[model samples]
Target: MGEEGTAMRMVLCETEESRRTYTLNSFGQTISSYEELCYIISGQYLYFLTEGIPEGMREWIEEELGLVLPAEEETKKQLEHIIGYRNYFTVPEQRMLVQKMRTAYLYSSVRKHKMLGDLYLKHSRYLSAYHAYQKSLSGLMQLKTKEQQEVLYHTGLCLTRMFRFQEAKEFFKRSCRLKENKKCQEAYFIVSYMHGDYQKFLEDGRALSFTEEQLSEIHENISGMEERFSGSEESTALKKIDYHRKKPDDLMTRRLTWSMLERWKNEYRREIV
Candidate 1:
């Protein structure tokens, strides 16, 4: 956090040298432009106010930043507007706010993106949720283990819902690596199984310390999927594995396998010709 008193005492920049000086005096942040300055001021004020401002500090901050601070009533109205309509902000506006919030606090953007992701996920907007989670992950710096794991788990869920099982499994794997919690471990196992790596799924379930009952539950879930998707491509792959053939199962694996086959066919076209 930038020192409020120091920020108030500092002079506005008119040149590169003065900007450098301001940055040095503030939070070691480089303020290059007017927009950057506004972001910094708002973000710093937001953080300071959230932490309880000292007496008369608010007036000084407002004066120094050359802006009128929003009153409680106005603030409430703005919050209502933002929260009431999911489409109140256009895509660009939402992105701009996310970037601007990054200047206010270390974790502000991350938290904002996570909130957006959860909202999108709840609405079944998996692609939007995935992008929001990606941004959240990108903003992570020196975050706690649980925080990182949480973002990773949710990212996996987004991918899973999109039917990108291979990518989802990778995310779940990364989450499990951070901390082998049951939720993440179970997700990883399910995703791995869904991606057609049943053997690896079973091995990892045990190696990752999942209980026997959990493993059985996971297996039963897989069995249920097999029964539900019978005669489908996924079920055919599962049946092939059951019969001991080296067949790729699951939608994603089958797609990749078919893509490879297509490439092979194209390569052999010249010989056939």
Candidate 2:
């Protein structure tokens, strides 16, 4: 062949090979080298490189190739798989899988931690849930919305479950201050009462307005606790009214204690000459 013809043929062959690399995923799409490298980092095509490229082209694939699909889809598939069968794995295996799932950059960090918190709560892992909710709050609490309120409330609930009412009160009060919700207020009053701060609940409870439904609910809790306390004769058990079941999430723990504070605030009076 002539030198000019040979040079032209070599150029055509090189172009065809380049086209093959870009079209490897059969997505019928082609992007710049920059975009392809992005695909590699996203891990959509990392495995494809080892299998698709010839040994001689390994360097080129590493430096200039790409993945072809959204990493989120793969992440979802993995999550689904884990949900379907992770119970079969040991605790360490589950932990490793969960940690691996957290590395999915496409997923929101708040959502990741919230889901982790929910999963932990499902297993009655209050401590783990508290930690997860704390992490989520770091990212979400600044929004000062219902989601933030819920996370703060959940954190308080976790602390309350662990018998850390003082710490729980801090979170519950913060949530109430951010947005005056019925739940946060009730939780705050309850936790404050639980921690032996009757003065706060009595002094603050009356000033905080309540919905008719909330008032009715609070009254019911008061009546129920009165009956329970009246029925018991054990003096040492005055503070242990939550013996039957869960406390923080239950209204009973706060019921007996809160009722006493309410009575003191409403019926009692001081006179000055």
Candidate 3:
């Protein structure tokens, strides 16, 4: 081969390799431009993902930069939502769109479920948040252990808000078993109080990181509840359940928890009044 012809062939070969190393996939789909390479390399793609892109911006990204995203229907819907609402509304407002996006495919998306759970929690919709987090935890395609502890914590918080203290206590303990945090410890104590396990709480709580002031408040609350119910029964002041105790199945446990939740709500109302 002539020198110039050989040099041109080498340049073409190097360009193809550069594309593969930078933006081309195994199937040979190439990102259109050097800007796409820059975005991928700099991690700025994440920023665009969070902020979302307008139609004009999307066109610019595709036409000017040649970065085509995956075109899956559910993914497109989610991406549009993520990109469409930048500086327009609070995330909670955007989260209402979850109900709109609740097709089977979207429901199967853990990211969607988790986003909906966050919005539900943000608005104090504990029941909705609980189920959403549960769905995310049990996602079929990929059960992410990375968020399991957080899911446990949030699910426990939801149960606590719903007045299902026993279940809440159990979930918090599960989260703590995975990884301990002060919030989880305090929440465990709070649920223990609600579960009427005051003795266990006081004994075990001493080892937790609650401030002395918080501990004093808990003591006062426990004392009041005890004084009022001392002659009634010591259900909460007793030891924790034994490991061999027969736990109910999910459906039965849910039914029982719902039944108990109603009673607790009435009791809570009476106390407040």
Top lDDT hit: 1
Better of 1 and 2 by lDDT: 1
List runs of model 2 lying over 4 Å from the truth.
1-105, 142-144, 203-273
For TM-score, candidate 1 versus 3, the one ahead is: 1
Model 1 spans > 4 angstroms off: 1-107, 203-221, 228-273
Candidate 3 local lDDT, residue 47: 24
lDDT of 1 by residue, 82-188 (tens): 32233334466545665554443454767657656665556445566678778878876545788788888889987665546678888888889888788887677
Q: Could you say which candidate leads in TM-score?
A: 2
Task: Give the candidate order by descending TM-score.
Answer: 2, 1, 3
Cα deviation in Å at residue 114, candidate 1? 1.7
Q: Write the per-residue lDDT of candidate 2 for residues 93-167, one digit (tens) a residue.
A: 446545554554344668567656665555456666777787788688444488777788888877766656778
Task: Show pairs that collide, candidate 1.
Answer: 43-104
lDDT for 126 in candidate 2 is: 65
| Cα lDDT tens digits for candidate 3, 74-173 | 4436444433333333355335443343332333457666665665566455666777787777662354554667778888887765656688888888
Q: Any idea what lDDT model 3 has?
A: 0.51
TM-score: model 1 vs. ground truth: 0.43
lDDT of each: 0.54, 0.51, 0.51
Superpose all Cα atoms of candidate 3 onto the true structure and report the RMSD in Å to 1 decimal.
Answer: 19.3
